[model samples]
Structure formats: structure tokens, C-alpha cells
Target: MAKLLLVTSLNKSPSLLLLSRTPSAPKLCPRRRCSSRADPEYLCRSIVPTMHYQKSLPRLPVPKLEDSMRRYLNAQKPLLDEEQYKKTELLSRSFEKGIGKELHEELLAQDQRNKHTSYISGPWFDMYLCAREPVVLNFNPYMSFNPDPKPEYNDQLTRATNMIVSAMRFMKTICAGYLEPEVFHLNPAKSDTLAFKRFIRWVPSSLSWYGAYMMNAYPLDMSQYFRLFNSTRLPKPNRDELVTDDKAKHLLVLRNGNFYIFDVLDRDGNIVKAAEIQAHLKYILSDNTPTPEFPIGYLTSEERNTWAVLRQKLLDNGNSEVLKKVDSAVFCLCLDDFPIKDNNHLSHVMLHGSGLNRWYDKSFSIIMANDGTSAINFEHSWGDGVAILRLQNEVYKDSTENPAISPKDMPASVDSSKAVTRLQFQLNNVLKEGITKAKDHFDASVKTLTIDSMEFKLGGKGILKKYKISPDAIAQLSFQVGFLRQYGQTVATYESCSTAAFKHGRTETIRPASVYTKKLSEALVREPSKYSPDELCMMIKECSMYHGKLTKEAAMGQGFDRHLFALRCIAASAGRSLPDFFEDQSYARINHIILSTSTLSSPAIKLGGFAPVVHDGYGVGYQVQDDWIGCNVSAYEVRDVGQFLECVHKSLEDIFTVLEGKPVKG
Candidate 1:
């Protein structure tokens, strides 16, 4: 196997942390700007203006053929019965010695051609962004912030000011390249990294640049800024057409159910002061006007294919200029009236914005409530949750700790030059009906989901540390044990592990429920009394080791799943159909992912949740704190996730007891 290597442009800076990661020999930056005058932003920001962390970031590597083959065969073991496993094993062996070599060569050649980036960028982008829509709970992920504990920070205007200020400051750091990239310290022995530098740059816009809501795939030539602080103007569908205005210079703010817009950046392109932003938000809240009867934002939550077709119909009526206001806006900011401390209410509002109050297509939108509560409703098309979550966490940190961000420090004045204005859309009868239909679709969709927020007190992660096991692996194994107890077998499971270690790397699947895990689960549930404490300990250790290895491989971009996916994509790109092995029923059955999960651990974030990718599956996002593990489990009506989580909680407790050398309970 090739050791991870990083080569950089002369302009790139060396990361101090990366140097620390491999301290014996350090690579120092050799080039510096020779010009007499430096960039003004660099001087003002008091930070480096280069991608220090990304300079030596390793390129995604092609795994050894035999290693990947063995891993693939092992991954499929848990999901298949004996007969199915044998068939999959046969198929795996055939591919390993046959067409798989050709595919591997093609992947290596592509990686060689694109030395600085991952091989999966183009295919992943099409799959993430332009390929799908309706863009609600399915693809779009959301995070709800903890309520402001301090009364002063709870004021909507005050909080909104802090948020905008913090965001501006953060963006400045990102632009200046002063931010640190995430280091994947998988274990002490080996490590990988993710290029978070792209996260900051990619979270701003470009989700809808192709055609704001066109059903037809007409490629549009529009340059989108990933860091622009402007708003995306989602004008109401004109005669059934959903249009967007991307040329706007201001952010669209919604308060008291009415929309308002003001300049986010001044004429000189510097971020407008937070006081100016607050003044505009306050101006919108001051007036009591009847909320618009047509809340078109709800339409975005309709079935994707349904919305695509309706959006094209809306364009046929042709109100291009009005649509432009919506298309070009950077993102939407909703200054809502109510305090949302309840998880259910928060999830509802964040997932599907209050009917008339959102332009769902914008890549990012912050909904700050009057009581200093807030949540983010972001388009999943642009980037994953890590980037947006980082942004939110930073904004929250600044707001909580920085006294200068307080609205009390504002210069008791408003910017008359940056006046807030409401956008008017001429809605025809068809468009009005579209809004009605969209609401119905949204209501129906919401009714199907049930989200349960749960926490397990395993005496903190330190308990696992004592046993020298990964806490995450235990959590994943607990889910497997619980599911096996409930469903009697493992369904295809998807545990998302980040592959951001490479340039523009997204994620690779870590199939958590392996054959070893399934065997353990079956033993635990079916014959707990038959297994001795030492035997159970060994089984648990084996399961954790299996999960840990798979996780590290995925993070290192050598996971079997994405490599297989890449092969299939390569065949399609070459105008050839996928091989028969891919079409096998066992392949689809083993990859269905009935339990979709990801772990987001941070001291700051309380809960991070996303709807299940499949209707029958459960989307579980968990945060493992020092003493407890908090999980937000969401499922459609098809599954009893609430009960499922209860089983998981009990299973976790049981595992801890067993590990502690206690006799099995019940």
C-alpha cells in the first residue's frame, strides 16, 4: 500500500498541526509573497492568507486489490444468509480476479490525472446536488441550536445581530485561511484528515444555479459565490413556475410572517455592520401586517419529481425578472416570533419552515426566534452537515462568549441607505393552486415522521476507555444488537463515516453490522445464558475491532463500498451497463441500509437530526458526551423507532454490565 502523501502549490502554507502529526520530520513552507504591499484583508484580519492545512493533505488512494476484496466479502456477511453469503463470496472472488482489475486501473489512472482532488467529486456532486429534489426531510439535513440561556442574548434582534456578526467574523477567518482543518485521529497509531477548507467555501450558494426550479435539465451559465453573504430571492411561483433571483445584493429576512430585504454587504463589498442588520430585522417586526395567504416556500417540500414538473409549468408563464430576485439571493434569514424549546416543534419548524416564511432553495437559512432560540434549515445539495454544523457551532460560540457582539453596544442608529424592502410576486391562479397543493404534500410528509430524542448514561465514554474500546463502535454494536433483537436479523445498515481526509472528499459508508457482529447479536439475544462472561467479552472485543478497522479504512478512503460504487459509475460513464454482479438481488438487499446513522460529537451541539433516507429506515444522529450519549432517532410510520430506541438503551446498559463482569440480566 502507498503511504499517504501531500504535494502542494508554492502559495500553500504548511499547517502547524500537520507538522505536529508527523513531528519527527517537518515540511516547511519555502515560498513567500515577494511583493512590497500585502493584501489589505490579510493585514486587517491578522491571519495567514493561505491553505496551510490543505497544503500537504493526502490524495485519496486506491486500496490494495486483495485487501478490498476481503473487506467486501466480510461486509456482506452480516446482511446475507448462508446461501446468500456464499453466492456473494463467489461473486466477490470473480470480480476480484476479473473486471475489477480493469476498474481499479481506470480509478488509478483517474486519480493520477486529478492529483489534487478525490476521484469521486464529479459523480458525487451530480448525485448530491442536481440529481434530486423536493429537497425536504429526505435529502436536506437540519440542526436546531440550544436555547440562549441568558435573557439578554435571547432577544431575537440581539441574537440575530450576534449570529450575523459571528458568521461574518468566521467567514473572514475562512477567507483569510486562518481556520483549522479537521484532523481525523482514528487511532494513535495511524491518522487521516478531511479538507474542511472546502466546507467553509462550499456552504454559501450554487445549490440551484442550474435552473431555479426548471423541470428540464437546461444547463445555465451562472457563476455562484460560495462565500457571498447575499440572499437567494425565491419569488412565488408565477403561474405554477418556481423561480429564483440570484443577482440580489441583499439577504431576505422574514419577521412576523412578512418578508424584508437589506444589503448584507456594503457597496465596497465589506460585510455590513451587525447593527445595520438588526435595524432591518427590527423594522420588519415592527409592523403588523396580515401574513401572505400564499406561502410558496412550502412547495419546496413536495415530492421531488412532482415539484420539478410543476416548477417547469411555473416557468412557462415567464416572469423572469421577478424570479431573478429570488435566484440571486445568497440565503434566507427568518426572524420568527415564537420561542421553540420543544424538540418536536423545533424539528417541525426547522424541517419545513412556517408556511409563508422561507425560500427553501437557498443553501443556508438561519431562523432566529424572538426568544433567542434558533435552528438552521439548509439545503443538503451543496454540502453535508459537518460544514453547516461547524458554521452554526462557531456562530453560537461567538454569540455566547463575545461581549462585543451584544446589541447594547450598537450605535443607536439605523442605516437609511440600506433600507429593507418587500418583494412582490404576481401570482396567477395556477400558482396559487400550486401553493395549496404544496402545503398538502408537505403536511402529508410531516405526518409520516416520528422523531425521538434519547440519551444513554453509560457512565460516559471513559467506561469504554477503561476497556480500551471505541465508544462509537459500542454504540453502533448496541444498535445492531437491538435491531437483531427486534427484527430477528440485520437489514442493510449504513453508518456514515467522513472521508473528508482527501481533497473534496465527502463520505464513505461504514457498514456497521458485520457477520461477526450479527453472530454476536444473535448469541446475545437468543442464547445470552449460554455465553460465559469471558466469551461475551471476547465477542464484544472482536465486534469493536471489526467496526474500528472498517471505520479507519473508510476515513482513509479505502472502503469497499465507495470503490464498488465507483466501478459501477465508471461502467455507466463509458456507456456500458453495470455488470451482472451489481444487478444481483443479494447486492441490492445487502445495501438497502434500513438503519441510517452518523455520529456528531461536540460539546456545543445538543442534537443533530436528519430524516431517514429510506421511508422504512431510521435516521439516527448521535452525540457522545463525556458521561452520556445523546441520539435523535427519526423514522417514518413504518418502523417503531421509539420502541427500537428503548431496546437500544437497554442493550447498551446490558453490554456495560456484561463488560463489567456482571451476570446477564433477564
Candidate 2:
């Protein structure tokens, strides 16, 4: 369960923080000097530079202590009985008037001292780094790309080659300060146009943010973009540190538990020929090297402290230079030996593979199955989904639209044997035993998890909008109803809301299990015959309205979770006795999170998911499309995931029926 908490703490889903805008097609740079590479025209240019607005972005605000306490008490109500609620309320009131107020002032002073970054950034990083669990299923999550439209482009070698080239283009575009800034345009016609870009470019970098704000456009914090490439999270004794080296010109490739590397960039910072990359990958795929008897990659999946000790041993045995090369590579490319069988199989493969073929420490790994289906499983500590999603969108669009290599194009007539370097590590008996234990432990842990998915086609965002309802709210309501129908009670539910609108922002929690939802769930699940269609419809409208309010507040940094979490951290660091509010059983129960959920919708994403946050909880990665709702659910063997999904499907049907002025049939 502690591992589960770490997963939720870092595994945030894509949120409404970003507007639905398709990335424009890449255009050749006209003003900047071109690279010496053959494909010089691949470089893209933006009207405004990538980090222009970062200096002018507003700092994340800390909510008033009273406001946070009120919100906290409200969120806790649905999960507690009268007696528990009363006692929790008394404890909260006492702390608010006493020690909590003192802690709030301390947090504000700390925030003032750290004006360069968001108040939550350091504490959030500490939360992730301080955890000792293996990150595989605990702190890393996956987002898979939709298959290429042109079936031929889905070939393994071609897709991998094209993606690698597109990724480099993105990296170069950002590093050269030519990539477009990440902005959410409320009215694209007004703010996402050439005129807006022209006007904003003239504004001083220090004042550029005001121009976007005037047009109802928001410029998100792009600080995390730096970690997308040439970054890796290094394990340490009590904490892990993130390392990035932009000078490294190679890409790491893992196949059959073996490591390989080759330079993908030239001295001029231009991408190498795609043909050369294809040829090198082809050679590695055809190599018949037997799987290592003790795969060093498995050590990455071991408990953090154990892996840290083993890593020091590897260094002691003269492996420091090799480890540095692995850490500094631009990114990892995993060529999997197994083909995806179905959507569920794809989810499992991307979430956590056999544990032998993956190096989970890389900032991000582009994994291509034998069948050419691919996904990105990334380390969650350095950044959230916003930066990765942008990369995914760009890579998916560029690789499919402007491929650098085609199937008909033969690999360059260069000897890949001379270009690619296979990395070898000398392992002692202790390290070998550690790797073996890691493999077995990983195998045993993943065996207890079950993943299932379902697609509802009756109605979706479009239909719900006709009734003036929020689609996200309704999706959340369905979960509440589904759980009540299946398990006979309401539990704490979490939906992540991104605060990227602020400088160095991370995420805030949206507590979806509100009193409105509790009432509606009971009405629909236990006594459907007692209420008229209009009555039930009215109840749904209320729930949607309240859920929308929660979403907006969370997005605006007015939510209580982060504020309370920061205050708690401040209190604990004060070297004083902790407040009773922190020790209340209700606090533990609320944070336990039985239904941990997140959602992401994009043309680039076929599906995405994370492991359950608790032993008895469900991790729901959902998307509400125009005419359908899709969910990928994961849980341990303690819960019946299949039955839960069925109940969710039924819940959606019932909600849709009620919206159409019809009674739900039992």
C-alpha cells in the first residue's frame, strides 16, 4: 500500500489543463541557420521561442488555512460515519485554531524563500525520491500511441527509425529555442492565430505572459521539458537523484536483456542519417546473442536501497564509465521480442514487461513490440505527463506525416557491426545473486496484478453536452455509482488536476467522492424505483455541477490536498510534536484512495494506465471520447476487476438512460 501511495503521488494523468488543439504541421526554418545534415529542412521554427513566457508565469498560490480546512472537511464527509465525522471535525477545528495556523505561516515563509520555483515542487520531488520501492509498477506509468494510419509504416524497424528521427528533431527544435511555447487557447480563433503570435513576439520576454492572459490563453510551465531527453534517475541509499547530460550523442537500446549503444547525433548537433540508425537497429534485432544468464537490467527493478548498494558494487568493480554512458544517453529504445496479442496484453506489456528487457531508470523509453505496436514507459520523478504528452503528440504526428525513412528505403550500406557498441558488465557473485533475486521478486509481484478494459458506445461527451452536463464529471459519477453497485459503499476517489498553469507546477487532487455523488450513487444503486426520471435527472445535474466546481478549483490551485500536504511537511520538519489532525484515522482512510483514477485524451494516445494505488484499490485510466467512453482498469487479486468493469458498463447505461428521460431497467 505504501508503494501504491508512491505511484499515485507521481503518476498523474493528462488533464483539462491543456486545451484540445491539434499541433500544426512542421515548417522549415527560414531565419535560422540550417544544420549540415542532409535533412536540414526537418528543423522547425516557431513564431515565439519555447521558453519565452516562463519568466513571466505566476507563482503557485497557497490557499488560506481556513479554506483548505473547510475543503478537507467537505471531502472527508462521504467516507466517514456520523461518529467518525464528528470526532474528525473536532480534531480538525482544534488544530486549525492552534498549531495548524502556525504551520500555515511557516509554509508561506518557506514559499517566499523559494520564489524561483513552485511551493510544491521541492516537497513533491522529495516525496518521489525518498520512496524505496522498485519504480517499475510503483512509480512509472505508460502511455501507448495509436497505430500508424499507413499500415506499412507500422513495421518495427521503420517505426522505430522514424520515431527516433522525429524525437531528435523535437529535441533539437527545443534546444535551439525554435519550438513553440505550450499554451492552452480558450478561443483558438482569437489567441491561437498568426496575429496573436506576431503581437506576442514583440512583448518583452519578462512581460510576454500578460499578452496571452489578455486573450484568455494560458502559457503552461515548460521547465520539465529539459528532462525529456538525456536524463536518467539514479538510485541512492535513502533517495534517488536525477541526472541529465545534453552532450551525450548516443541512444541506448535494450533487447533480450542486452544493452547496446550508438551515436545518433553528429558533432554539429544534427541528427545522423535515418538509414544508419535503421541499419544499426536491424543488426541488433538479427543478433542471436543468448539472453544473459544474469541480466543487469533486472537490477533496476530491485528495491531502491538494494539496487543502490548493488550499483556501488558495480562501480567498485570498474563499471563507472559504462554506467555513466547508460545514464547520459539521449533516451532508451527497447526492441521487445514478444508481439502484442490484444489491448489488455498491450497494456500489460507497456506497463511492466518481463522485467528482464527494460531499463526503467531512463527518463523515457520508446518500446516497440515485435508486432510494431509501441508505447512510452517513463520515470515519473523528473516530470509529469504534460511534457511527455507533448513529445508523444509531436513524434506521432511527425513520424507519420513526414517520415525520414520509408519501407522502400534500404538501410545505408554501412557496417552496423562497427557503428553499434554492445555494453558488457562484469558481475561478481553477490551482484549475480542480487540480479537473480530481483528477477524472481519482479516475477512474483507482477503475477498478483490483473488488468481489464471496457468500451461503452451508447453515449459519450457529445450526448452529455446536449443535457448541459460536464463529461468529466459524469465519468466520475459513473465510477461512484459503479463502486456502490458492486461493493455497497462509497470510498475515497482521486482524480488528478494539473496545475501546470503556474510556474514549476505539478498536480492537485480532485476529490470526486463528494456528498452529491454519494447521494446520487445510493439513489441509482439501491433504490432506483423510488425516484422519477426527472428526480434522478435533477440529482445528476447537481452532481455534475459540483464536480465541475471541484475540477475548476483544483486546476486553479485552490484545492486543499497540496496545501494540507505542504503544511504537514512543514509541521513535521519543525521538530515539534505533530498535530493530532495528521494522526486522525480519517486522514489515513481518505488518503488510502480506493478508486485511484486519471484520464488522458489525445489523437496520439491509444490508451494509458498505471498500477492500482492500494492493495484493494482500482487504477482507472479512462478517456471520454465524442461517442464512446473507454477505461483500462488495474487491480491486485484482492479485487474482482472484471466484475467491477461490468458494473461500470452497467452504470454508464443507466446514466445514459436516465439522461434520455427513461427509467433504468433492473
Candidate 1 contains a number of clashing pairs equal to 25
What lDDT does each candidate get? Answer: 0.60, 0.83
What TM-score, over all chains together, does every model reach? 0.82, 0.95
Residue 373 of model 2 has an lDDT of: 98
lDDT of 2 at 579: 89
Worst 10 residues of 2 by lDDT: 20-29
* Cα error of candidate 1 at position 267, Å: 1.4
Q: After superposition, how far is residue 499 of candidate 2 from its true place, in Å?
A: 0.3
In model 2, what are the clashing residue pairs, if there are any?
A: none
Model 1 agreement with the true structure over 560-619: per-residue lDDT tens digits: 776777777887788877776778788787666677776654334455566776678777
Q: Stretches of candidate 1 above 4 Å error?
A: 1-47, 53-56, 178-249, 304-319, 403-411, 415-418
Tens-place lDDT digits, model 2, residues 1-666: 222111111212214221100000000001112222344435468778889999999999999999999999999999999999999999999989999998888899989999999999988888888778888877787888999999999999999999999999989888988778877766667988889999999999889999998997788788989999999999999999999998999999999989999999988877989999999999999999989999998899999999999999999988998999999999999999878999899989998999888999999999999878999888877877677877887888888878889989999999999999999998999989999999999999899989999999999989998999988788899999999999999998887767778898877777899999999899988899999999999999999999877877877888998898888888878788778999999999998878888776777789788887778888888888889998888999999999999999999998999999999776
Candidate 2, residue 200: how far the Cα is off, in Å: 0.9
